[model samples]
Target: MNSHSSDKKGILRRLRRIQGQVSGLERMVEDDSYCIDVLTQISAATAALQACALALLDDHLHCCVADAVTRGGDAAREKVDEASQAIARLVRS
Candidate 1:
């Protein structure tokens, strides 16, 4: 199974909820909702997305990347490099 398959349903559920929040934000803008209220929802949606991303990153480190390292040799070294690049990219973003 894929490393994230176990949490797929839960992750998808969270994504769908975030999608709904975004849709609501669109409606809020269309309806001219208060600025603070819309901003609050936007902040919440951002937090939700960030949370999902962190969870997937954690799973990748613990599963695929860890397994690659255990395999040893060049492949392990490559996986480490790949993980480091991914982390750097995430931090930069």
Candidate 2:
């Protein structure tokens, strides 16, 4: 496969793992686990999600966003705005 497809597959794998972590955290809460333990699991899940998001953002900046900028036009400006808004949302979370 091409490199883009390979990167998407890897990202999907990480997302699935994060999904499992979230499920496990739900189970922990259902089991009435200690407050600190539950919070810790939540923290871990959040970190995993953030890591995946950051990885995707890095890839976009390096490839898609870079290409858009190189093209140089309204489309490039739009892409930059879109990417900036996305990063802002991610940071807010």
Candidate 3:
């Protein structure tokens, strides 16, 4: 099973909310909203996305990485590497 299965609903809900926020941002742009206001909304949306990423990373460490460590050998090393790459991407972002 997926590591985040337990949080699937919550993650989806967060994503849906972000989607709405993006739509609202589009409308604001279309209506020529103030620059600061648009930038603020963009920041809020970015923060929400980061929050979701953090939650998923937590789940991955607790579930996927934990499981891989238990299994040992190549699987364990692969999981560790995958997690490292994920962290790197998040850091770059």
Candidate 4:
């Protein structure tokens, strides 16, 4: 039911990779890996997640938002406001 249903598989794949990275980070801690090394991996994982969020946002704009705007009514304004809120959340995060 998502606008990005077409990208679901790819997004899930990336999330799985991020999950693996998190596991690796956990293992690194268990094995007493260097702090900087662990932090580096953490940073990489964070960036990957942010990239995924941005991609989803882009898809929402192109698909859901576009469709709502095409309708040209209260729904259009609502969709735009929703998008702005989403962007604000992303930026704040």
Question: Highest lDDT: which candidate?
Answer: 3
Winning candidate number (TM-score): 3
lDDT per residue for candidate 3 within 40-82, as digits (tens), equals: 9999999999999998988898899999999999999999999
Estimated TM-score per prediction?
0.85, 0.88, 0.94, 0.92
Q: Which model, 1 or 3, shows the larger TM-score?
A: 3
Q: State the lDDT of candidate 2 residue by residue for 31-92, as single tens digits.
A: 99899998998899899899988888888887777888999999799889988998999989
Question: Candidate 2: lDDT of 41?
Answer: 85
Looking at model 1, residue 58 earns an lDDT score of: 79
lDDT of each: 0.85, 0.86, 0.94, 0.92
lDDT of 4 by residue, 5-88 (tens): 658888889899999999999999999999999999999999999999987888889889999999999999999999999999
Tens digits of lDDT, candidate 1, 1-92: 27455587888888999999999999999999999999999999989988887777777778877888899888888878987887887777
In angstroms, the error of model 3 at 32 is: 0.2
List residue ranges in candidate 4 displaced over 4 A: 1-4
Candidate order (lDDT): 3, 4, 2, 1
Show the colliding residue pairs in model 3.
Answer: none
C-alpha-based local distance difference test score of model 4: 0.92
Clash pairs, model 2 backbone? none
Q: How does candidate 3 score on lDDT?
A: 0.94
